[model samples]
Target: MSVPTPRSPAAAPAPTSAAHRTLWRWHFYAGLFVMPFLIVLAITGTIYCFQPQIEPLLYPGLLRVTPQGEPLSPQTLLERARAAAPAGAVATTYTMRNDPRASAEFIFRLPSGNSESLYLDPYSGAVLGSLSVEDRFMKQVRLLHRALLVGKPGELLMELAGCWTLVMIATGLAMWWPRLRESGVRAFAMRPASGRRGRWKEIHLMLGASLAIGALAFVLSGLPWTAFWGKQFKAITTAANLGRPGDAGAGHTHAPVREGNHAAHGDHRRHGGTMESLPLSEVPWATGLTAVPVGTSASAGHAPIGLDRVVAIAGSRGAGAGCQVALPGTPDAVYSVSCFPSDPKAERTLHIDPHSGNIVRDIRYDDYGPVAKAVSYGTSLHMGRYFGLANQIACAAISLGLMALAITGFVMWIKRKPANALGAPSRPSSPPPMRAWIAGLAVLGAIFPLMGVTMLLVWLIDRLVDRAAGVPSRPVRQ
Candidate 1:
């Protein structure tokens, strides 16, 4: 069989307006560039949203245990956990729950350069088995969601894609704007047609519009973690008069303590029937104090509080579900108990003196600043736990819609061919102005730092390519 010749350039049609052509060209190319990233994000996000339900099923043994005898003391559990680890490694124990049937977990770094986790019978202190962090389904899904199975660069790329997704949503809305007035319900509603092209277009427009808000929410919430948005958020929060002045050297600052009897003190020394407070700096051991262990304190010479006592104290103190009891790390360390009472709410961080088992400080959710509260809620929203079943269902719906949007977009792009090169018209054109294109690009770039940088890079590359192709440079309209 004879090989067919390629179509001649002369047979192609010319673009209506150079600017309209450029906008469409960029849209097509950018969509192509970000498609893989988009797919990864959608898949990972879908998996991550179901983690609360899926994780327990995947690691049932890791999450629970059968009652044996009286629960082991937190101190005893710590020692047992430490003994299980290799030399020089520190053990972190979580004091799980009061149900003798409930399991407690100890996490520690092994000499083999891997972290090891073990589930134990809280009552008998019997080690259940070692767990591999890598073997955890949720961990793997989270990694894929945040980093695309790669490291920092992948994370950055994902963030960039997230930013671009916002852009895509906006552009898509602009493209869909006409339908708002003309078609009403049919435009906003899903109405699949018989033709392949019609179905693809319908899918693209309807799904994109439906998920636009959700996609924007995810992007805006996630931006706080990106370098650019982190700084921007800091500035915005500062300017909004939300929190106290942040320390120049510190990423955060504590609200100044009120000048009443509740001021923070350094040491717990006994004075005239009261505690003799020292400057935080004057307390030599305070400098080394990090997270207090669940039931031990520095005042007690950093002796480990027995696991049983810690459990008793936590129960007595009404430590709610999802509470974590962290062990004191150093000589002056206090055991810290952190708990979240509800979804989309802040946590309570409580420090207790190990020796006396007295509560040192209690920081409730309401005590946190607005930004801190926002951060907590944003995290909950990201995890799809902000509102309960309704929120989770909404997230799942959005993820499915996003997947549909992306697939349909790709199909639509594939279905349409570029205009012919020799000034033929596929159809008569009503092209948008160059100024409109510039405004759209500027708005998109302003909202997404990565898009701004990418736009600059694209312009530079286009300049170089045109120069090499002996084509004259087109002046950007003022």
Candidate 2:
């Protein structure tokens, strides 16, 4: 029996093509660089998806009230809120009809050279008390998520992470693409097999593929808001005739009118009374002016409508649920009544002159231009509000998927051995195929300006580390 024992089969040698090795290296290194950020994004994105539901619960008293009596006027609420605060503090009141509750908030400059927020209830006009940004859970989470508790550097890191995520998706797909004829496309998809490695691979592939499109959409839409991409996008948009035009009167070539000096003009207009003019800045907060106020157009003579009246008008105009009324700042200014109807697609913005209560302007989702509509839709998608429950579910699933991808990727990296050889030292492989190397470099350079720069830095660091570690380098031959 001892004599009959057969020799164990040797393990198959790993593939060693320069292209394959380079692809794996980039994928591995990029995964290492981006894992921490991906985790932060996943956690934050998951929490943010439920903000609409969570915010109401967290501030229930400020958001809702019993429908026992009529609500207070916006002006009265604002005054009450200010009385609750310091002497000079000004409060902004938000009167919400759908929830039957009102809220007032004031931003104050503290003695410590920082801004603080004080929340108040408009229904009872009681100060809920001041809240520090640090103490605010959502604010802290948002800051950490968007910027890693650091400022611009943190934001840049996040943008880089997002860009790397796209890279990971692309490289991952490329690596997973089966070259062999026998392998099914489903194999490249998700294949749940028995072992730990098999399970991890399945998760990595499945989650990566499922959320790739979503992640790409999120990244592309957000790129226009990034520093470099924003400038580039603005330039491109302007070149493509998509830029916002300057003010209508800009660059008008009208001849300049030589009006008399201030004193002369004042004397000339004194007799007309109707020709009197007031400073634009004083119009909103002005206290005294006996005669019919100067610059009183046809729309300015009627009585001003309060927030309550605005809400009533909006309801009468068939606004859907969750209507909000914003009071006019000046007599001639228009009250903005905005509503998000039961129909998730319906969003209406109405501007009504508070004086005459006449509708000055109306803009619905249907009225938006192509770019405006796209922007609105993109915002809705980003906030997970475009399709309500379905969107929420999709976002949640995407978050979970992202988390899974990160975990599995980390595990895969851990399973791989350090770059070394068995028994004897192995020679360095030749440079990668010229075409493949150029293509990868070009693609990466096009997508991330930082990549080429980072690669050069990495090369320098690698050289230093190799020298410091006393690892032998390939000899140069002349």
Candidate 3:
């Protein structure tokens, strides 16, 4: 489990520099574990980035519309979606789509525990199509990105992949480091090809070196979504009042913090309230924070104002065409108007009084604290939403570059590996370096829980294999 600290080449140990060989070994082993996942992630992430472009192409009949007239009212669309829903299922929030040709999308939680997404033509109110959210193509891709589609278990594996990717990147950088001092920073420059292996090696090094910073950005940005690490991060932000405006879990405080979804924010908003549970909707940050203000009268007998009226109210206040009006599922709940525009600066969240149709709470992007603003900006950039086509193109290019790097690295391994054994680097000539490496890994494992577990397992297996055979598992490369 020991790893070597990086060093320059000229003053380094001669033929078998343990630091160089050890780091190369780490780079090799980590790549063996991480290459397949990176390929899948890059491919899926590229697909996801172009979702605005690809979905219409894939499901044109269901997604696109004629835009012949003013589309049906929000209430009518919801009713149509409900009628179209499978028996014993209930429709929840309706996603306000940006495209005029696009159908109104409704989310339905089925009795079978799977969620179904219903798409309806806004003009005709006809059922366009229904897809199980979990089984849907993009959902499956997203699951593959987060986890290997195995739910919680898959999440751990994906997290492990992510952690080791860090290891891969670090060791890969170490391996590339000597090139900088020796060849005058030529790792970024592809040399003229000498042989097939040499050709792949140059290209691989150049690609890795060129995209290293960007790849690092991608990995760091994605860390906010890992189950354990993400939660811990969110907890810190919430506690510090650093991210997500008005997102305090202890209900409204002088400090506001926002979590990713309206549902979680709403649950936190109701931390100390006594009214019936509120329906989960994609709400803006404020509505989740704004409890029925001090004077919200109990107008129990007056049945809630219909969805159309609430939509009109939000429209008057500039809830853009892309904003959704979520009707309260509970008697006490208010209308939640939420919109997440391509520009993170345009995010808006509102809570509407159901009885009187007033905007009780309105939170805009400008209200976000410093940390929240940075996070939102970073998240938007990561999603390829910030610069329109330029953003999409850049994200796609990085993804393709990552896949290329993984492929070339794998090909290099195949070319070099001997027939009789796994072609890992030889053991370092010294053993003392390992204790420090193990300590560092322990810290990494603590931060990335699954990585810690995996490292322990791998360490134990390596130890047992070494003991049983009276030697190291792989051949000494010296």
Best by TM-score: 3
Q: CA lDDT of each candidate?
A: 0.59, 0.54, 0.70
Ranking under lDDT, best-scoring first?
Answer: 3, 1, 2
lDDT of 2 by residue, 219-281 (tens): 665555555544555455445534322111122111122221212111111221110121111
Q: Rank order by TM-score, top first?
A: 3, 1, 2
Per-residue accuracy of model 3 over 47-150 as CA lDDT, tens digit each = 88887788778788877888978889878988888887999887666666556878888888798877788889898899988877767777777778778778
Candidate 3 accuracy as lDDT: 0.70
lDDT of 1 by residue, 350-391 (tens): 556556555555455555557756766775676577787677
Worst window of 10 by summed lDDT in candidate 2: 279-288
Superposition-based RMSD of candidate 2 using all C-alpha atoms, in angstroms: 10.2
Residue 334 lDDT in candidate 1? 58
Span of ten consecutive residues with least summed lDDT in model 3: 271-280
The residue-level lDDT of candidate 1 at 223 comes to 68
Give me candidate 1's TM-score against the actual structure.
0.74
Looking at candidate 3, what is the lDDT of residue 33? 90
Error of 3 at 219 (Å): 0.8
The C-alpha TM-scores of every prediction are 0.74, 0.68, 0.81
TM-score, candidate 3, is: 0.81
